[model samples]
Target: MNRKRTALSAAAAGTTAGVVGLVLIAAPAGADTTPPALPETTAESLVASVLTTDVPALSGTVAVSSDLGLPIPGLPTGDEAARIYTDGEGKARVSLIEGDGEKTLVADGATTWLWSSADKSVVKYTGGARDKAGEEQRLTDPAAAAREFVTAMGDESTLSVDGTARVADRPVYQLVVTPKPSERTLLREVRISVDSETRVPLRLEVLANGSAAPALSLGFTEFTPGAQDASLFTFTPPAGAKVTDGNAEVGKHEPTEQQKQDLLNAIKPKVVGSGWDTVYVGTVPADLLESEVTTEDKGGREGGKTTGLDLVKQFGQPVSGAFGTGTVITTKVGTALVTDDGQVAVGAVPQQVLVDALGQK
Candidate 1:
């Protein structure tokens, strides 16, 4: 839900496409039963409904299954489940079950807490009324995820309602989105099941080219819309848990306009190409390029540490072109090129697409 963390995890694990794919290709799969018949609605009206629908107070369990075919150090693979709770206002809580522990996040008004049972660590963040950290967490929800994708995929995509099905016991209209013929992407099509009554999305599925089964899917197995208990959004760090102030120096000083722009420029990646084949070009911190990620008892590799550059080199193949030489990491739905000079070009496109992206000034 943290955009910065998502980007870092994607870069560290060579899952750029997987992370980005979650947003760009959000949808749902079909149910095995006979398709349900729902009142006819145009794709435009369905998309409009998702955009206008205000999320109600609810709690649900999300089942996530990903087959990116790429390994991210320190992360578990295969199917995983997460619990979500929201008060329909500005308060929310999410709990994710890890291998032997749990990670819980709660956002109560201006304060947000992230507790990790694995490390016995707690991080607290405080911001003003406009702070959207909690709202962004909604992206993990099927409804919110599908809403974002529908909003962004307009014009360049073809939208249609193929049929209807039941998701989470609620009848839903199946809205399908596919890239136009001009867009070159590894993905096939996205299927989203929107609730017929409330118009909220209930499930989403993404299929990659040449894959009959969904390459990635996230949807609610259970959903209840109502007022959540107030206690769910409140949090207090456990005794002896390490506490870190996520925004300790928030109001300590004001940055100059130039300084603010400079920082933004440094963090924002340069966009190359467009549509589903869009590439993001950015510079990795010099120190990070020399950094190493260590894992303990993971996949029979005990206490193994790999540097950033070494990581790409080990997982990628040597590649060179007009943009110069680099190592390219390829997966089922994406590719990433890490040049020797700490520059990275990542996208859901092919290796040559990455090369061409970098070739442009």
Candidate 2:
């Protein structure tokens, strides 16, 4: 649990490429066929405007599409769509639509409810847990995602206003972000569509090197900027559904100081290099290294069974270097190296970059 907390914090800070990919997944404006006409504006002004603009009460449908090209067994891919409602006053609701059921998360200023329709279960959060849930909810918001990139942009990047386009039927200004010549990354550029009137980002498109289309795209398919129903922010568990207090077990089984240190030493999360080439280095927990992830049969369909070692043998290629022998899993936007000794190095860079990162002391 401590490792999970540490890893999540690291990812939230943008220190790991894998988490960056996930955060980016949390929401893009896709390319529109016809370009819109917009008045002359500087990237500086646009950035400032997006940062300062107050988000008004709104509701929309968010569509996430990814083509990472890593078809790991049991991993969900392609399109994931959700509906979002916000009162623009710290109260919000997000419903993630799955195969046949829905998972809804609602935060009503002071409390948060996470309900799963498929399992008929709900988790209620209060106090600090409620606040944490609200923060995680914003990660899936396109405007928040856009602001993340804009704020994360550093001297290593070059930004400019490319053109104007219409996203979700609203005219928007397109801002393009590209890495400097010295940065080594598989990503080519990031494109964001900012609403012309609200200055809020409507869509984000991330294209990889050598690819014409965006490897990942997230945006609102339907957006309405106005006050949302107050009822949407409140939730009541259905009859017969099981409810659990999310904060009830906070100190029920606290780990000793030595145990915490031991777990931290075992994982040993480390970052090598900087910028887009940065790699996240860690060790595979012994339990996971020895175990496998097998899908369970659900809805009468036969579950596909596979092991961790099986995946490495099936999808990874053998690589050996100064860092030692391991298998490297390559995707359209990133690469992961898994050493035979249970070490791992992952980054949005070439395989050699991962190898060099692992070789670093």
Candidate 3:
């Protein structure tokens, strides 16, 4: 529903890809059942059943890809492994292993934490934290996380029986979900594979208009439900690790009028030539331009000044990925770097923030 919540879903979807890949290998193949008996269940009812079922605790890997139809610059395409455990109390722990290090994202029903192994740091946020902070943030509850898929189901009436399939050796019913007539978006249809016996969704495929390929697909592997320890909902920061309370930080940092003006002033003239130019105090200095270019590693033999200018023209805006490429930048008034495609930029101010500052004059 919210951007942060959407991001959490995207992150979870990305992580679930790896898990699906591992479990898909064990899935069985068979001819499509002609007009298989579709379950007479509503999307809400089906989702509720999955949440309450005594399924086994799930653990597996996932891979993700976004920006399906459109081409976005600096986005990485790869697979990430994830392991998830749910205790049916609207709580879950998901650990994602990407490359050499692991990132642990947990929702203890109340708060969410994204722990990075490389930095050994944890960024914590609660549901209400974003509201008090007046910023978008991620959802931490396991049920809330799963609801992303259910919400995306669009119109309930568009759902229809597709066929039968097997996921992780379990027979599943394939149901095609389409957008409601009232809904207007690029998304055309979504196909969900549900466990035939349990009626829980095993996989979801999103198809977009004008695209031959489905935009995104996510699958849940090793589905299980049982009594889980209460400790699963609690997180103890690692030894010597810095704990950041996102709520406190948001409360402490309120931009002043001058600060806002400065940010606005920083972005003026929007278009500066590729080469360096020294503007006045109110103007973006040529050296500052060079610095921006150099910092992004987009400079050329002459330090990429011309190349940076070309990029500006191509993007029709000042492109800043100072944090990294995959990071999504969203801002209320300033720029925020998304570390991963789904991670919200917490403390870091985006390049636009400086641009806005320069525009103040």
C-alpha TM-scores of all predictions = 0.78, 0.82, 0.51
lDDT of all predictions: 0.81, 0.83, 0.51
What local lDDT score does residue 347 receive in model 2, on the 0 to 100 scale? 87
Collision count of model 1: 5
Q: lDDT by residue for model 3 over 1-361, one digit each (tens)? A: 6999999999999889989987777664432334445556665555556556544444433334443432344442333336666665556677767669987877776787778899888888788763442121122122233346555443333656555666544666666666565443345666677776755566666676566565665565444545666676688788899888877776678788898787656633333211111111223333443344432433423443453333434433323454333332332212322222222222112344433333333
Error of 2 at 242 (Å): 1.9
Better of 1 and 2 by lDDT: 2
Off by over 4 Å in 3: 1-62, 66-76, 109-111, 125-127, 130-157, 179-187, 197-199, 209-212, 229-231, 252-361
lDDT of 2 by residue, 49-155 (tens): 99899888989888888888886544336888889989888888999988799989998888889998999999888988675556556656888888887777656
| Best candidate, TM-score | 2
- How do the residues 215-325 of candidate 1 rate in per-residue lDDT, one tens digit apiece? 778888878888999999999998999998766544445577898887667655799977788999987777788987774564666677878788779888998887677
lDDT of 2: 0.83
